[model samples]
Target: MSARPEQREDRRKDPVDAIVDQWAAVRPDLDTRAMEVFGRIFRLSRSMGDRMEKAYAPFGISRGEFDVLATLRRSGEPYTLSPRQLSATLMLTTGGMTGRLDKLERAGLLRRSPDPHDRRGLQVTLTEKGLDLIDRAVGAGLAVQSAGLSALDDEQVGRLADLLRELLAGTPGADH
Candidate 1:
């Protein structure tokens, strides 16, 4: 399903409309057909993120915050990791991870301390409060994600995941 025509009509008149129009004119000979599927995926990703954010609202945490806490929770016993470890594991830069840690700390969900093994490093640990919050938030997030995927049966979802994985693996920088 898509947004109503009333919503789409407004976008069609927007500035970026010219890009698609030009593409259609210049590439009439080539297939250029994959654009339809990939373009919708890009657009739907944005809309789906908005929906997921709204679903996280009741927990009073942004999705990014939840991601950090969840990562720490899943790291096994002691439920702690160094800032460097978290940043690398989450594919975030050091500065970006620091900002996330600051917000979570202010929310009383996590705490930071000097790493015992490395003077230059810091360990980020989920506070008891942070652990509880993530536990609940994760449950809610799963429900929302499951509902979103309900349009496809379990078997279909499995096949789709496999195909996507194969495609991703064949792409350059996938291993990087």
Candidate 2:
């Protein structure tokens, strides 16, 4: 019912190969070489994100929620931050963060309090339950990501990371 290693490898035709072939046949003058890279990268990004979300499902959190908790957890002592700070750090809009915060607060995973520094502003902090859950979520997330990238050897992965960093460095809003 399952494929052996060779059978699996044989069936995997580097999906982009087919895409390139298809484009080449229809548009003889067009150069689709970049398709080989971006196509796979797009698919890989989506699939990896899906797998990571699955990993969070058992912990009863979406990737967004996990990110919020994890960010708060690592934000040093008091584990607190203003809504604006959180939205900025996560690249989310304050409006979007409000929905997430409301959900987390209802779950008792985080709490909001009056910001001492700014009257009429609120700060968010993780509850004890949130801290514990995020600790486990982070551990599980790392494991899921690690397993997903296991096809690459250490040197290959390191090189890939460096290459990705370079690519990210040039992209707008990618945090230079």
Candidate 3:
């Protein structure tokens, strides 16, 4: 059953505030209030990630694979990226990127070819089969993300997005 507005607000407050209360109880001088926001953000991230993983499951790819495919698909026509470019964009180790590329190539979703710009390096591109799979996977992934934030009204969601964008932009290690 759906909660009444007051009840829903109370439910949200109780658990999260209880955490801060516990910290204040044991260590009164310490300020742990930021935990409320950071904790919620962490929970939201995990929940959305879990949902998106389920969304990608039918396409037979993990979240990391989906990330690579989506990055290539978004890179515009030719849908190609060098292994270095992909690894940098994804912040993956060379071995990690190589592993994902190997799995996708084996799955017949993508292929690696000699980089035209740098003959010594290889580039990755989505096959026609990869294109179709990623198109569907992206659509499904968006649906999952949309549903995850459906609790918020449009204005709240927009405001939250803006706030998050600002925070992410200022944070260390976020894409500059």
RMSD of each: 6.8, 6.3, 5.3
| Candidate 3 lDDT over residue span 1-176, tens digit each | 21111234445565666777677678777656467678888887888889889999999999999999999999988999999989988889999999999999999999999988787989899999999999999999999888888889999999999999998888898754
Give the alpha carbon lDDT tens digit for every residue of 12-90 in model 1. Answer: 4433344445665776554433554456557767867887788778988988888899999999769899988888877
lDDT of each: 0.79, 0.86, 0.87
Q: Against the hidden reference, what TM-scores do the models get?
A: 0.80, 0.88, 0.90
Kindly provide the TM-score of model 3 when superposed on the true structure, using C-alpha atoms: 0.90
Name the better of 1 and 2 by lDDT: 2
lDDT agreement of model 3 with the native: 0.87
Top of the candidates by lDDT: 3
The number of the candidate with the highest TM-score is 3
Worst 10 residues of 2 by lDDT: 1-10
Q: Put down candidate 2 lDDT per residue, 51-153, tens digits, no spaces.
A: 9899999989999999899889999768999999899889998889999999999999999999998899999999999999999999999998899889989
Itemize residue pairs with steric clashes in candidate 1. Answer: none
